[model samples]
Target: MTAARDDHTRWEELAAGYALSALEPADEEAFLGHLPGCEVCAELIADAREVMAGLASTAPAVEPPASLRDAIVAAATPRAGLPPSPRQPRRRETRRSRYAAVAVVAAVVLIVVLGVWNVALQLQDRGQEHRLAAAERVMACVEQPGCRAIPLAAAKGGQVPVTALVRGREVSLVADGLPPNDTTGTTYVLWQKTGAADPSPVAAFDVTRDGVAVIDAGRLTDPLGTTEWLAVSHETGREPPAAPSEPVALGTVS
Candidate 1:
């Protein structure tokens, strides 16, 4: 029993890492391998997915740069010339060899340029994701019906106030006062309870230095038919136990 409990705890820690996209490739693969058989871990992943969906929804939409598109197209096109390889001896063998060397050099340069361009595209995508997340939080109250806004003040000596919204069938939780997540193996999990039998999962998210996040609470199922409390907990793993540490924010759906 002790060994099983230890394993469960380790798995939970892995679940949290997976939720935050902080797991290394190998660990992520292992976590995925265990996902099919672990209901607790699966629930954690589902909640994390909700948080990711909210983040994606809020990310700013960006169009690809014209130059980037053009460059990509040009790179993909095949040059209608001899392939870059040794050419048979012709009348001017030495000159032909020199030309071939230059061609090879040109191809190498093109490859480098394409690689740099691809990196730039990826960076742009990351920026867009950040912008969109911020925008999504700002627009939450307006976008979903039955959503009411609540201002969460900082605990102490904090500057930013978090704005959260309760809307039809879900809650839009956006905050800017939390500390940046710097730990190598930790993540935040969100939970919702109706003061009934059990607390339901909401989201598992990675908090930024600015403590900004947009948590999504989809339609919840509670015996009490009420959604009243929300909480955040720090844990490791790909899954957390069913219960949260403590209630961070409390409100009602109505």
Candidate 2:
């Protein structure tokens, strides 16, 4: 089971093929047999496979044609009719080709990594934009006539202060010392109550790291004059609930 030093280049190519799952049956068998003995090829395969793992999750799904596999096998397979070249020149050429092959694999993996990172950054920027838009809405509501600030009392006598800003049908919440909504399938829900009727769901919101949120609660079932009270509840799901599972704060409409 001795591998000639000169065959390292061929093994490197096979290692890449093994990592990418593109090797022919014979090549795969030979590479597996060689892998336990050759640390260099094992490392190459490990690095390439790590890159392939990331591609599986983030890369768009595309089915390559059957001919593509045939082409790759044909290209990777060394020609049978080649004459033996000078040892010194072949060694030099092999080193260059080996580096080139490794570089290509690295470049492709780099591109995919950058693409995923770029998408994450874009989503973050979009979230910031939404927060800014919500802030602007709160400001707009504040400047409107008939907008009244109502301080919400904590249901359990906690010191966290929550305020409800109401103008006609539009409602916004300004709060401090609220906890983060990290629980799965849960959200902060704003509910409005009129007279003896059950609380009606208004809107859902998210709190920032500073425990503050300027939530634009959309519209109410009744206008500001008719609304009896407003309450914020921590509830499951983004959809408004029929009843509050956990009432965090409440404000009486004056």
Candidate 1 residue spans exceeding 4 A from truth? 1-136, 139-144, 151-162, 182-184, 208-211, 215-219, 222-225, 247-254
Instruction: Please provide, for model 2 over 1-254, each residue's C-alpha lDDT reduced to its tens digit, 9 standing for 90 to 100.
Output: 11364567678777766666667789789889988997777777776666666666765533333343354445545579997554565446655555555555555455545676788788778767756765565576668787877778998997746778787777777777678775567788888888888888888887755545676778888877877888888887867777877689988887
TM-score of model number 2: 0.53
Per-model TM-score, in order, reads: 0.38, 0.53
In model 2, pairs of residues that clash are: none
- TM-score computed on alpha carbons, candidate 1: 0.38
Instruction: Give, for candidate 2, the lowest lDDT window spanning 10 residues.
Output: 61-70
Clash number for each model: 17, 0
- Model 2 residue 231 distance off true place after TM-score fit, in angstroms: 2.4
lDDT of each: 0.54, 0.70
Residue 30, candidate 1: Cα error in Å is 54
